[model samples]
Target: MAVLNEEQEMLRDMAREWAVNESPVTEFRKVRASGEPEAFNRDAYATMAQMGWAGIIVPEAHGGSDFGYMSAGLVFEELGKTLTASPLLATTIAASAIALGGSEEQKARWLPKLASGEAIATLAVDEGAAHDPAAIETSVSGGKISGKKTFVHEAHGADLFVVAAKDGLYLVENGAGVTLTTRKLTDQRSHADVTFDGAAADKLAGGGDSLLDDVLDRARVLTAAEMLGMAQQVFDVTLEYLKQRVQFNQVLASFQALQHRMADLFADLAQMRSAVEAGLQAVDSGFGVARAATIAKAEANRVLHTISNQGIQLHGGIGMTDEYDVGFYLKRARVLEASWGSSSFLKDRYASLGGY
Candidate 1:
């Protein structure tokens, strides 16, 4: 088992308390009703920024907290529990790209703003149904890029976009030949289908094929951490329901078959936790990050799907209704599973990396 140090534990507790006190289920319900994917509560985001979450992984020289990936993973897990909609993941992933591959000038310009939440950034990598980096259809010519990128998370609100084109990465300023067509995802977050027509872009210096692969591996692991939180939330909610919900003249928790199911779920959740923690450590240690990330994400994807479905099933008809909260977890799980890469995609990645 991976043990968090005192500082990391404090950070995790802080995020948990904030999510409970400020952005509870009631707040999430309100956000969903607003019909805007970028409709995250600004005050909550400000609070997170104040807590240094936005800069958790950024270097201290860049006005960031300079925490490691494990600490960042804890934050992501906490946010996942509430299905909180924010630019946190996008910003973290983009910042990682810059920190790992961006030139000194790029980091000096973008890192501070990202750490301070002054600018929202997102990665635009998917151009089609596949996750092949080499298959990127977007091409750059004369410092301009053109192509359509689909399923760009939080693109509608991002001030900058870290785009992958022609197997190379570049940063394109928002509205620089970039047009966003928003879509309402299952998770209630805003995903955009972005079209670029000769968009002016600044290429990140020294970002080769390996850099993209490295950053993508980090992204996958971070996503798995988030899914772990979601799965745990589902488990908690269902457990609570079982303890109180009565059927056949007794509480549902008294049934043997249902008890066994919950036990099985607990086992699965434990395995997922182990996988996620190992992946986070691997990312931090720079050891088998890609393969570990693939394993973590693939396992998380499977567990989240099972947990969400079971949560709904245990809740009976109320689970399917919009009035209930479990439906939200189900929806969010589906969206998270599809994001970055799907289970099959990650599995293939794991296989390509050789034995698990």
Candidate 2:
């Protein structure tokens, strides 16, 4: 486990308390039931911004706390526990792009709004069903960007888009020339295929050739943090369930076979936590980020898949029902697993990074 500083511990505790009391899984249920395309409560997002969560990675001069990636990961993990739905992650990823590659004018124009949650932003990359930044077909010409980005996260609520074109990243506001086709995935979160038909774009031209990869590393690490939280919650919930659920005239938790199964899950969860925390720390330290992020996300994909399945099996039939909260974790896990990179994708990338 990563040793947290005093402030980090406080932040983690506060997020945990708020997610449990203020925005529990029931809130996600409400959002899902509302059938809104945004799929998250606007007021809830405003509260998060007010709490300084929206700007954790933003520079202090730009109205953010500049707490770095690990701090942001802490909040993400807490929110993941209760399946809290918000655009915080998407916005943070976009903000990181600007902070890394945006011109001074670009920062002045967008970072403060992003930090204060006065504006919503998202990254538009990958124009396919799978994660593939290298295959981006989006292109910029005459200060306009034209192409489609499939499954853009938080698309419905975004006020700005940090888009990836063949040449580089660009900023496109949500207005004329930008069209959205809503996509409903398993998690029922806000997603859309965005068509940028000659949308005016401002290029971000400062982070050198590796800017996109750096931003993506941030996304992968932060996402793994969220998965860590979900895996932990599922393990906790399943363990508690086993203690109470009786089978064959004895408590299921007491069964040696079931105990061993849970023990295995516990070990996997521990490894996932380590990889995720190390990834977050690596981002903060600016050390071997690509390798660390790949390992973190790969571990997250592997462990969460197993734990979510085991959560269902240990609970027997009830785990599949909507009434059970464990089912929600599984649904959300599947979507996240496919988001930045799948296990196979990360493994290949890791090998390439190692020059194998």
Candidate 3:
């Protein structure tokens, strides 16, 4: 675990409290039951914005705390524990893009609204089913962007989109020629196939050639933070279940084999946490971000996959039931594993970065 300062500690504790008390897994169940296209409570999002969580990376002049990515990761970790459904992650990633690449005029126009959560934004990078940023075919012509982005997160809820084009990144509002075709996934969250038919686009040209890679690195790291939380929760929940569940007149946790399995999981969880925190810190320090983010997300994909599955197997028949919260974590974990990058994708990226 990262050694947090006083302010970071307070923020993490506050987020933990709110996630546990105000927005538990039951809240996600409510969102699932509502079946709203956005897949989250608007009021809950407003409350999060009011708490200043939406602007963790935005500059202070733009109505944000500018607390950095580490702080943002802390909040995300807590939210992940309870499977909180909100556009906070997508919006923050969009905001980071603008902060990194937008001009003064662009920042003035969008950052404040994004910081205050008055509007929502998300990144649209992949055109195919997999996470391949290099394969983006979206293009901008005559000040308009035209392409189809599949599986756009928070698409229905986005007021703006940081779209990836052949030349560079562009900012397009969710009006005019923009259209959304809903695509339901296992997670049942806000995702869509966004079609931009000659939608007006403003170029984000200031971030240089590496802007997209930088933004994606941030996405990978923050996402890894969330996965870290989920893995931790699954481990904790599974451990508690083992202590209570009895078989053959002995508690499951009392079995030496079961204990050994858990001990291995505990070590894997520790390694995942280390990589994730390093990724977050790298973003803040502006050092080795690509390498760190790759490692972070890869470890996250590896450990969370193991932990969520083990949680199900350890819980026996009850784990697969809808009544149990463990199943929900497993479902959510699968969705997130494919987001930004998968374990295989990250491994390839890591090897490429190392010049292997």
Candidate 4:
């Protein structure tokens, strides 16, 4: 586990408590059933905003607490436990782009709103079936962006878009030439496909392609944090069930074979936690961030595959049913496993980062 400061620990505890009491998996089920047309409830998102979660990484000058990436990851870890659907991660990731690539004036104009949750932002980076930042076909001409972006996270009610174009990252406001089409993900969450038909845009003023990579590295780290939380939650539930489930005149947990499997999962979970914490710290410390993020994400995806499957199998058919929340965790894990980068894709990138 990552060692947190007093304030970060407080934030982590607050987020965990909030997810358990206010927005458990059952609450997520209610949101899915209500057909609210948005990915998350507005009231809940507002509550997060009120809690200062929206600006976990933004500098204090810009209405943020100046807490680093690890702090944000702490809260996200809790949110993943409940499968909470909010723009918090998407917005915070977008905020990183502005922090690294936006000019002083741009930061002055946008960071405060993002930190306050008065505006929601998303990074429109994926342009095709493959998740490649270098594969951006989007073009920027005449101060406008024109292309289609798929797999846009937290786009249901986004206020701004930090877009990846052929030239580099650009800022496009929501209106006029921008069109949003919501897609229902397999996880019962909302993702958007955005069409930028000559949407007026301004080029990011600070950094270049490397900055885009930096923003993505941050996203990958946060994604790993969420996956770690998922793996832990499912493992806990499965462990409890095994202890209670009786078969063949003995408790399931007492079976040596099953016990060995869980013991292996526990070991894998520990490794995944180490990778996630390393990624978070590297991002905050600016040391080997790219490598750390890729390794963490790849390891997390592997751990999730093992833990989720073992979870369902150990539950003895009840895990496959909708009445059980473990199934929801599996569904959510599948989506996240593919998001940012899959285990295989990240493995390749990690090697390439080493000039292999």
TM-score of 1: 0.97
After superposition, candidate 2 runs with Cα above 4 Å error: none
Rate residue 274 of model 3 by lDDT.
97
Angstrom error of the Cα, residue 117, model 3: value is: 1.0
The superposed Cα distance between candidate 4 and the true structure at residue 133, in angstroms, equals: 1.4
lDDT of 2 by residue, 5-95 (tens): 9999999999999999999999999999999999999999999999999999999988999998999999999999999999999999999
Please provide, for model 1 over 176-235, each residue's C-alpha lDDT reduced to its tens digit, 9 standing for 90 to 100.
599998877778887889999999988887756588888888888898898999999999
Name the regions of candidate 4 deviating beyond 4 angstroms: none
Inter-residue clash pairs, candidate 3: none
Query: lDDT of model 2 at residue 129?
Result: 88
Off by over 4 Å in 3: none
Q: What is the C-alpha lDDT of each candidate?
A: 0.88, 0.95, 0.95, 0.90
Q: After superposition, how far is residue 178 of candidate 1 from its true place, in Å?
A: 0.7
RMSD of each: 1.4, 0.6, 0.7, 1.1
Q: Which residue pairs does candidate 4 place in steric collision?
A: none
Return whichever of 2 and 4 wins on lDDT.
Answer: 2
Residues 279-321 of candidate 3 have per-residue lDDT tens digits of 9999999999999999999999999999999999999999999
